[model samples]
Target chain A: MATMHTPQIVETNHPGHWKKSVKTGLKYIPLLILIFFFTFPLVFMIVSSFKRDNLQIFADLRSMRAFLPVGELTLDNYRAVFINSNFPRYLMNSIGLTIVTILLAMLVNSMAAYALSRLKWRGQKLALSVIIATLIIPGQAVIMPMLLLVASLPAISFEGGVIALTQGWLDTYYVQVIPFVTSAFSIFLFYQFFQDIPKELDEAALVDGANRFQIYYRIIVPMSGPVFASVAILTFISSWNAFLWPIMTVQSDNLRPVMVGLLFFFQRDVQWAEVMAYTTMITIPVLLFFFLFQSAFVKSVATSGLKG
Target chain B: MTAPTVPIEKSEGKPKKERQIIVGLLMAAPAFLLMILFLVTPFFGGIYFSFTNQRLIAATETEVVGFRNYTRLLSLSVLPLEPVVDETTGQPVLDETGELTYPRSREITRDEENYPQYAGLTEWFTFDVGDTRYVVLAGDPNFYRSIVNNFFFAIVVIPLQTGLALLLALLVNQGLRGQTFFRTMYFAPVVTSMVVVSIVWKFLYDPNNGLINEMISTLTFGAVGPINWLGNPSIAMWAIIIMSVWQGVGMQMMLFIAGLQQIPGSLYEATSIDGANTWQEFRHITLPGLRNVMVFIFLTITIAAFQLFDQVFVMTNGGPDNATTTTVFHMYREGFREQKIGYASAIAVIFFLIIVGINLIQRYAVKEKEA
Candidate 1:
């Protein structure tokens, strides 16, 4: 995970280094203590997640008491979530949505970016500006209107507005994935990076009889893999974690994503243990994905000046 | 380059510009269309509906009336949104404009008569709670209490959350051991479902058997026994705020860490050699180094906090006598719960304006300072 640091910063010793070090060290204590203070809640949550029952957790939730206790180790809760509940399906649903959205987003955003940044077109700046402006407008403001649009689509629509769609937009896979495919931020991210890439390659490709699509597909997209990975990681996390919009739209139990499924499962007149198991399972994929590619993605962002 | 499909005319015009523009439009068309249809159109429609009495559901048609929604929601004398402020003037607990911010709502407790005018409006809107004629009015006294309460939360929690995030960032960025683990742990909640967080926290804040109150009872001082974390209207806001900070600290911390990582070590060393103390070094070096990050994080956090909805939706529902109701939640209630879409749209519009204004002020402040 280590990367090259600015050389001058590598030598931190100063002439008054000892006295400054003392002060810095002194300052670190209170700061560290405060970090512990703020992080105590998370500490409690993780500890509680392992408990076999509530009594152990309640006994010493804040302290490390519960975690240390020789409580009965049980897989009952995890079993309940994995077998007794819809958690698996929800996980699949979430993964499906996230993967679909990620692929769709990369294609749409990169293509849009290629057009905006690499294509020497008049109004390229205008297109770029529009993409940036999209960032300013909050999504909540238009949710209701967006709901109407979702409900009114052709194949997705219900009969004569008599009801919501039959195989309606409600709970349909496309319904969940379609509205989210185009990300303004991703477009802007790639657009900025593409602008940095030399355009002479484009002229050469054009001279070699390459059509616009080939130039983008063969050259630009391949060269921009690092950023594409970063944007993909971000989109996957967001899609997996998204709660509100999905909850408001998706109605069928079969189509429920992990987050909502976990909510319902936890509230199932069941134990917190099962809930923890559900949460742990839901977190597994993202945790695995994050740990795997985070270094490469972070490097791309740092070098490219793309702020999340 | 096929020598330009139409070599001569294309060569004269360099037609690359027009073709590129066409490709740009085609590539972006879907997203552009969605933004307009889903975002901009609904916003304008929401404003229009805010003027009428629109209810959800297909069976019912809305009655169109100009300014009636506003007329209906006025807190006093049937007037809506009287500019309210926090008590003990200039406190973050209360905003400069009257409204409950929610995060720092620790300090307000109300007696029944505290907001009599608001009570009258609710009574009028509901056709009497138990037999009095209800009047819908702005500046109504009863609802005003909740407004003040909301301001308290926004002021206290917003800054507390942001400050704590910055602090954690500074600490965690000290080239410490297990840095990655700590960062991931801290960031867990940011990625977890807020509904789950809110529900779990609501259970924790459950007055009698709840962990927080239990801890308080064991403490040596300060009303340690059986404190009503959620039940008491006074303490409910703060209780919610505490949970919120816990739920949200991860994102801000991550952003700050990213910011801190960008700081140059040489600057710190140079300042140290110049014989500056730690605090002075922070003032001159750390603060300045993180200025861009600080501004971005600050503005982002504030905006997110201001639009507090999901947590409130799952946890308090702006309840325990409306102590935790925020501007956004209030708009939600007015539009969806009460079937007053027009009024809610007005609230949403005002909320939108606040967000935009805050962004503008941030932009100006940062630009001017940087210059």
Candidate 2:
């Protein structure tokens, strides 16, 4: 009988020995300084949000000015962002759009991907390959054509014939949010993940007389929470951050999402402080999403096709 | 490759091929139809519209201009390259450094060369081209300046972003104390809305009261030496490049860290036994391991840098003197803002071919070298 080999791990990988085992801080020291530099702007933004809105704020344009006590901090900036502006509307718009898009996209992609990956049919591989190939094409090159698609949808004229089909759809949420809700990356991610699932599970389910849809839903999706979470994170973040397309699509003031609102947050006369406050407000959801799913996100991104 | 004369006789009491097809189509209908209508059609339509005068109207309008736009774009004279010209003495003085060097506001008079220079001097200096007089537009020079600036931005920013990202990734992946926390912080910018970042940085870069100028003045002198960070023709593009690197490096870092994690510890241990120091270890062990990841990072960043629009859109809007207009931004402005959709499409087609060609050559060269 052959003996089984045990995997060996080194003790030096431990954090306690990391500093000691490595004498050249020169190597790691530069990295530390860079991380600090890269992260400082965000830190400064969060901290400054707490500062008093007195002359000290404006006068002390120098970040190194006489330190104001933290106790003197006020909620005035957040107050200004929320109360004085249409920030609440904008917030709702962004959150609603992100949530809807993520759910719709994930459901659609996972179903199609499961069908494509798990179901056996001729040329299925070729179809999946073609879909994946489209991802390499930059979204910008296709934006105008997309604009044309949205524009071609008959106008919202109830009196008209063809335009009547889209009578209320012209400037509705569907036009603004639906165009971008489909993602090739999501489909590809789900396909790769679905393919990795042992075929035995599907076969077992089928042996029990479960239909294809039932197998996908009851067997596959229940086991795919982590991938789902990661996809959800990416989809939400990307959708929330989406700017150009939304700008091109949404015309109604009430319908304008956070990105569009942020675009025109400051009118011709821009106030820098107010803009920062607005920026902080807009990024809150994204920041929260990343904080919650940083690990899962990294893994999902690692698995997502590395091309772009 | 298989012969296609197979018939599926039902074995188990389940749905047949036709039945499966119906169910499959029903299941996949929403996504497939949406993808085809929105994605596939736009692609074909983009190519078609690139050849047609299909700008102002919807898809119904069909006017084919037969390569005229392409010919015009191909024959374009690069907008002249001069920074703001001094009105009194037509000499140009602009900062080429990628740092914050431009002076705040109108501190410079005619005596000081840093005062804005105008490129509209061609009216004064007539060219004898077929005995006709020509007047140059003042803004045209800025366009060419931006194109050059765009190159500088790409060259400098991509390497810097990549290098720092690699360093951070190595550190975090070393299983350092509180690694996840630091990793999270590093990548926070990646997930954050770039528009918000740009807006916030706009305030931060404000020449008058931006936190950046404030910090600099306090650290050095008390004077808030405001830099025209995203304005002034000089350092505008570089400023955008700095912010872009800050927001983007995390992604590259993630890739590098992943790459680093894949390298077997045995190789490093073996190298260490041979007395390879930190630099040597990186150059030999770590670098060789990271070559594939590095190529991916390099090309991805290069392409992303070329498609630089969001920063220019949010921060500069093609700028104090059109100094930050990268190719994509130029294309957008031409097609959408100027309503010269045909001309813009030509630019896009040319750009598409260039990107594809470059990508193929890179892959081919890398493959050959690997072989």
> DockQ: which candidate is best?
2
TM-score of chain A, model number 1: 0.79
Tell me the TM-score of model 2.
0.82
Stretches of candidate 1 exceeding 4 Å from the true structure:
A1-52, A55-63, A120-123, A156-168, A295-308, B1-9, B12-22, B73-150, B176-181, B214-223, B257-266, B337-340
Please provide TM-scores, in order, for all candidate models, with all chains considered together.
Answer: 0.78, 0.82
Q: What TM value does model 1 have? A: 0.78
lDDT of 1 by residue, A1-308 (tens): 02223333554654556865686577557655655654554445555566777665666644446335346667676776778888778888988998899998888778877776665555567767777876766666555545545666655434566665353365677778877777677778788888888989988998898878888889988898778987887677668777767766788889999888876776674476566666666655555665566565344333322221
Top candidate when judged by TM-score against the true structure: 2
For model 2, give the RMSD to the true fold. Answer: 8.8
lDDT of 2 by residue, A11-68 (tens): 4454476655475555567657766677666665665666665354566555444233
Query: For candidate 2, lDDT tens digit of each residue in B143-219?
Result: 34445665778699778988888878878887666777778888888877787788778768878767777777767
Chain A TM-score for each of the predictions: 0.79, 0.80
List residue ranges in candidate 2 displaced over 4 A: A1-32, A52-54, A63-72, A154-164, A167-170, A268-272, A301-308, B1-15, B57-62, B76-150, B221-225
